[model samples]
Target: MPISRSFRCSVFIGVSLDGFIARRDGDLHWLTSRGEAAGSDLGYEEFIAGIDAVVMGRGTYEPGRSYDPWPHEGRHCAVLSSTLPPDADPRVTVHRDLGTLLRELEERGTKSVYVDGGQVIRTFLREGLIDELTITTVPVLIGTGLPLFGPTGGDMPLVHLATRVFGAGVVQSSYAVDRTT
Candidate 1:
């Protein structure tokens, strides 16, 4: 069962109304505070179920490493980092280049990926490698923090696929990358 080379990279994340994924100290308190009303997950389970693997930046992986029990269990996870410490989690492999990482995953039969972390997502977007994005906008706005999108070289057009509003005042939108643009 060889993995197909036609890999689809997608992003599923939540950002504050002002566009910050995490607070100044890398805290996601504002986002997590509104925990899925009644374990709803706000469609995260559906999105993640379609992904074969997860890729994130070193900054994102480090924090999860400290969790009592790792968050992404039973999934092939890769961290993009050149300076990843030697004690990094055994469950994850470190890589320096995004292209090479995707190629390796594709060769392993990975068809879809969930691209995560602020820096990793921005880099993938800038490279025009992202295929789809499902961004959930949390109502509360944090004045300052890390933004989800930084300046890419040029404008990247996205085609709206769907939109949903949750009872928690959260708005989730899905978009397909307009590669032809």
Candidate 2:
């Protein structure tokens, strides 16, 4: 039955209009150089409150885990990597199999899941597992860097939900997934 179950997964990320999430060397210099009042993050607090767990890739871990903030402290965090140590964090778990991970979460009656990281979000989109995507696009553009949406095998459809404008020239858009034919 194709692991039939209803699971709600969301992607909350910041990307440049050209589609890069960060500079080539993983430096978010472009993002940091922007004005202090740039971009609207008004809905972020509410968005975070609606999720039960979060999944992210190695590259995405640094920003969220740095400075002892413990971004996902209260929520279950799944780091998708085969190389990470088994005992990485008390609140975080490493996962290699996406299916197994979702199944486990579903079994626990998890209501919402947040998928972070460019690669991780792409994977969820490709697998038709993501239900919503909320992307904030900054004004600046990085010529060569890590892209938010890499080359996918096919097209995915999305229904526009809402948009928010932040300080400086930042814009945020939200979309609900539409099953692709």
Candidate 3:
């Protein structure tokens, strides 16, 4: 049976072996240190290419703001936060509720959405909104840090789709949320 929805929501993120997205101080040095070989992004380029927009939490948006040229340049990016100031970029939108954000995206004819950030992803998963997830796990383990999966109420089953191994023991896996189960 084909899954049907007004818009598809997906997650593409990197996590430590122990399931941490960033270190104690919100540093992604563990991930950034793994320099990419020429013309290699472990399928990230392909993944982002298919996404129509991005939805992230305040935690994720703040760090991205530090980038010389915001990472999500051309994409329609929605920051889910109530405390942050309004976005200066016209492409970026500030939303307080995920439902409203999704509705707005649907109205804008968004077909696929890339849901990011630890807290944002967790919330989407808890609400049974995520359609798919592609998680790349790095080799190193940060004992204390921000975990990717915080208590999400109940199990959300997934069907394995694909897996690829990159240099330095980085493993990327994709899964489709098994909503029927």
Candidate 4:
């Protein structure tokens, strides 16, 4: 299925001013610095409230899956992975392909989905499935760490929608997808 067939999907992430999402050791301490306005979540709460479902990468969902209290209590959550045990909760469906997963979500009347996790977001963006992106750039930079985006096959130019200063040094910019390449 073509990416356009899906109802809608967006990516929201926070990166350092230099484009690192976490340290080389996967520590997110740089993103938690109060002096750099890292405490702000870049309006993710509002964004999550507006989404009908959330699709995340296996690595991203793994840690949260072991939570004593699952966070996505009432929302449809899909973990993009074929390795997940089948005994997992029925509410959580494991998928191997992004296209197939998207098709299923569309059939289920999912109006919108939140594509989260670094690798997962990159995959969605690379496939031209993301309709919008809301990225918050923190003021600090991690010399070595995971970047918000990696090399993709093509160039994706975005149209600036709006920007907001959340608190202190945290500023989020919203962009619309330029589908007409």
Give all TM-scores, in the order shown.
0.91, 0.90, 0.91, 0.88
The alpha-carbon lDDT assigned to residue 63 of candidate 1 equals: 84
lDDT of 2 by residue, 52-114 (tens): 889888778756666477777778888887677758766677777877778778877888999
Instruction: Please report how far candidate 3 places residue 55 from its true position, in Å.
Output: 0.5
**Residue 167, model 3, lDDT:** 82
lDDT of 3 by residue, 1-181 (tens): 2333588999988888899989878998887666253125878889989988999888888777778877788788898888777755565798877667777887888889999899999988888888999998888878999989978787878999999888877888999999777
How would you encode candidate 4's per-residue C-alpha lDDT over 1-181 as one tens digit per residue?
A: 4455647888887788998877776777668573245455567778888888889987778767878778777889988887887557676888888878887898889988888888888888778788999888777756778778987777888999999876767878999898677
Q: What number of backbone clashes does candidate 3 have, counting pairs of residues 3 or more apart or in separate chains?
A: 0
The sequence of per-residue lDDT tens digits that candidate 1 reaches over residues 94-172 is 8877667877797778888899999999988887778899998888978999889998887888999999888678889
How badly does each model clash, as a count of residue pairs?
1, 4, 0, 0
Whose lDDT is higher: candidate 1's or candidate 2's?
1
RMSD of each: 3.4, 2.1, 2.8, 2.3
Worst 10 residues of 2 by lDDT: 33-42
Q: Which stretches of candidate 4 lie over 4 Å from their true place?
A: 35-41
CA-lDDT, candidates in order: 0.84, 0.79, 0.83, 0.80
Question: Pairing residues by index, what is the TM-score of model 2?
Answer: 0.90
For candidate 2, give the lDDT of residue 126: 75
Q: Candidate 3 regions off by >4 Å?
A: 1-5, 35-39, 87-89
